[model samples]
Target: MATAGKDTTDASGGPGNTATPAIRHSKPPVNHHRAPRAATYSTSILPFERSPNGNILAAFCRAAYWTQGRAVWGALTASGDTKHCYKMDHARRGRAIIINNETFHHDLYLGQRTGTDRDAENMESLLSELGFDITARKNCTAAEMKSMLVEAARESQGDADCFVCVILSHGDDGAVYGTDESVKVEDLVAPIKACKSLAGKPKLFFIQACRGKFVDGGVEVVDSKGKHGQDDEEEMESDEVAVQTIPVEADFLMAYSVAQGYYSWRNREQGSWFVQAVVKVVRDNWRRMDLLTMMTRVSHKVAYDFESNVPSNRFLHMKKQIPCITSMLTKDLYFTPKV
Candidate 1:
C-alpha cells in the first residue's frame, strides 16, 4: 500500500517498453449516421498565464480524472481490499467527471490494452490516490461513451465543483472512435453544459486518440510580432472565483494532442504524447504553479519531446498546440498549502 515514492514494475515482464502508436491518417468508416444531440456550444479562446500561488494538488486531481488513472510507469501501485478504488470524484475543493471506454473490437490497434484488466488496475491506483471515486469499464460500445458522459455529469452535481473527462481510444474530427462505433464530440461535451451544479465551473477534457488521417506538408508561416503582455496581465489579475455564463459556456478548457483532423502520437511503450506531458508536468511543477501555467509547459514538452521514428525513419510532426483556456473563473486557484 505504498503511496509516496514507490516503484513497481508492471507484470508484463518488467515495464511495457513498446511505445503507444502515434496517430496516423485513416478515414472513419462511413455510416452516414449521426448521434443524438444533448447540448452544444462553440469553444472559447482565453489567454494563458501562471498563477501567483501554486495549487498543484488540485491541478493534479483534475488531470488524474482525465487520465483514466494511467500515469508515470509505476507511481501509484497499491494492492489489497480497497472498495471504491476505481472511481473519479472531487478532492478537497472540487468534484470530477470521468469517462473511460477502453475495450473496443478486435481492431488492429487499441484492442490488447483496451481489453485487458491491467489498464483498469493502473487507473484504479491512480484515482484512489487523489481521493476520487472512480467508475471504469472495458469493451464499451460507441454509444457507451455518450451515455456515460450524461451519467457522469449528472452524478457530479451535488458535491463536485469541476467536471473532467478522459477519453482513450480511436477518434476523428469532432468525434471519438469507440469499439465498433464512433461517438460525436458533441455527445460527450454537451451533456455537462446541460447539467446544473456541474455547469459554469471548469469543464476539462483530455482526449488521447487520433483525430484524422491527413498529414499536412511542411509550410513556412510568418511569426506574429504580437506581445505576450496581455496574458501576463490577466494572469496576475485573476483573484476571484470563476463560474459559468448564461449560455453555459463560460469556464471550460479542452486539451487536445493534435489539431482538428490530425493524429495524436503514442508509443506501445510510453502511452501517448498528451498523457506523458500531463504526468511529467504535474510531477515536476504541481507544487509550484497553477493548472493553466503547468499545462502550458506540458503542451510545449509533449509537442517537442515526442518524435515519430517509424514509417521510414521520418519524424512525424505535430503542430504547436497551446493548452486552450475557456475561462469563466473569476478568482485564482492555487493547490499549494497557503501560508
Candidate 2:
C-alpha cells in the first residue's frame, strides 16, 4: 500500500460552506421525563495494521504526509480491513465520557447551547463506532462534572485500554463553565489522573469551549502539483513485542478546539466547529489512522477550511479556529472495531 506523499479530495466537500449555527434566546422546555439514552450502534469495521503486541509500527507512519495542495479528504479509504482498536494485556474495550454544558442559570451567561446537543449525539455515534461504552451527561455543574469523571474512573482499574472525555461548554482560560460556575480544567483532570484503577491507560480529553477571545487569519500557501488522489491503507505489522504498563497520566492527550487565549466557533445548526470536525475525521478514518493523525487532519480542516460567517460587532475580522493537542503518549493509539 502506498503511504507517502499522496493527495486526496476533501471529504467535507469544501470548507467554510456550512451555515453557522444560531443562538437561542429562550431556554428549551425542561422535559419532566428525560428520554432514554441512544442505543449503542457498532456496525462498522475500522482497523489498522498494528504490531503483534498491539503497538503501532511507527516506522510505517513516520514518513506519511499530505501534499501541499490537494482536495481535503479522508486519510484512509474503504480499502482497509476492519479491526476494533486494541491495547496489549494492559487494556481492553474502554469507556467514553461526554459532558454537554448547554444551559446556565445565571443571566450573565446566555448558555442556550443550541449546538451542544448535536455535539453530544455525534460524539456518541463516533466513539461507539470504535467500541466504547459511552456515558453521556448533560448540563453538569463544576462539582457534578468532577463526580461524573470519578465514577467513570472508579472502575478503570488499569484494565481498560483508554479513557475519553469530551466537554462542550462556555469556558475561559484554564477552565470550562458549569451551570453555576467555572471549573478549572486542571481540577477536572486531577481525579482522573490520580485514579489507581486507570494507571497506565491512555486518557483522552476533547474540550470544545472558548479558550479566550482570539481568532486565526488564514495565510496563503503553495500547493503541490500532484493531480492524483491515492489512499495507502495501513497494513498489519507482524512484529510482536512485550507490552508493559506505564504511568497513569503519561499517555494523556488533550485536544482543545482553539488555541489558549482564543474563541471557539459554533453553529446553532451544525454544532461547534471543533466537535463536528472531530467526529467527521474519526468516522471516516478510525480504522485506518491513529488518533493523533486523525486529529491533525481535523485541525487542518477546521483551521484552514472553516470560518465563522456570523456577523459580529465586537470582532471585525472573520474568525478561524484550530484544535490544539497536548500529549504525553508512550505508544500510538489505534481504535479498532469488533468484527
Candidate 3:
C-alpha cells in the first residue's frame, strides 16, 4: 500500500487549483497464472500441417488470405471515398490525449487506482504506434481535465485524420473522476465534437473506469457439443467507424469499459481488462479491421476473458463485465496502418 506524494498545481494554470498527485513510476510484475475457483472453459484446438519447406501451411494460408482480403477491401474503400468508408489518408493520424487519474485527493474518499499507470503506458504506446502525437497527463482535477480537452479542441486538426481521447479513472454512468471531483463524460466530448477542424473526422474516446458499483454474477451457459469436465485441468483453454456527420454528434465513438450500472474490474498489477483488450486487439487487427469491428472484439475479450478473483469477498468473486460502445458515426472507420 504505497502512498502517493503531495499534490502540486498544474503548470498550465487552466483551472482547478487543486494539487495534482505525484505519479507512480514503479512497474509491478504482472500475475498471469492465478488459479480460478471453478474449472476454466477451454477453446477448441485447430490441427495444423507443416509444408515440405517446414512452414506452418495453415498459418501461411491464413495470413495470405487475410492480406489478400484486406488488399481488395482497401481498393474498394480508396481515399476520398467517404460513401463507403471515412478517408484515413491524411498527413497525420491526428492527436491523442490520455488523461489518467490514478490517485485521488484525500478528501475525495476515492481509493487510488493501483494499475492505471500501466493502462496509460499501454495506451500511449499503442496510439503512438498508430501515428498519433500523444499528450498524457496524470492526476488531473476535473477542471484541469476539462480545460485540457477544450484546449485540445482549439488546436488545428485540418490535416489530421481523426482525434482520440482516452480517460482512465474511477467513474459512474456518464462521468469520470479527476483528482478532486468528477467530470461529465459528455463535457469531455463536446469540445472535440464542436471543433470545426474535426467536423467530419472521426473522434474516438476510450474510457476505462467503473460505471457503477453493481457486480455482474455471470450466468452459466451449457456447451452445445457436450457437458464440460469437472476437473480443473480439463477445462483450461479458450478464449468501427465512420463518420460523416453533418450532424453535431455524428462521427464520435464512445467506448466504455463496463455497461451502465456495472463495475469495471482492474488487476492491481495488470491494469483494466478493457484497456488491455483494446490495445491488443487494435495492435493485432488494425491493419484490416474497421474500428467498430476491433471494438467488438475488445468487448468480447473483456466480457469472456476476464473475471474478478476476489477470494475473500464472496459477493465480488467471479464477477463479470461487458464493455459498452456507443457509435454515432455514419461510415465505416478503419485505421489504415502506416507504412
Backbone clashes in each candidate structure, one number apiece? Answer: 31, 21, 9
Q: TM-score, each model? A: 0.55, 0.65, 0.73
Q: In model 2, what lDDT does residue 211 have?
A: 72
Sort the predicted structures by lDDT, highest score first: 3, 2, 1
Per-residue lDDT of model 2, residues 123-182, tens digit only: 887776566767777777778888878777677456676788889887766778766666
Which candidate leads in lDDT? 3
lDDT of 3 by residue, 192-306 (tens): 9789999888999898876766778877766312122111111000000111212227888888888877777666555777888999998788777789999999887776666
TM-score of 2: 0.65
On TM-score, the leading prediction is 3
Q: Write down the worst ten-residue block by lDDT for model 3.
A: 233-242
Deviating ranges (above 4 Å) for candidate 3: 1-17, 20-73, 78-82, 223-248
Clash count, candidate 3: 9
Off by over 4 Å in 1: 1-103, 106-130, 216-248, 311-333, 336-339
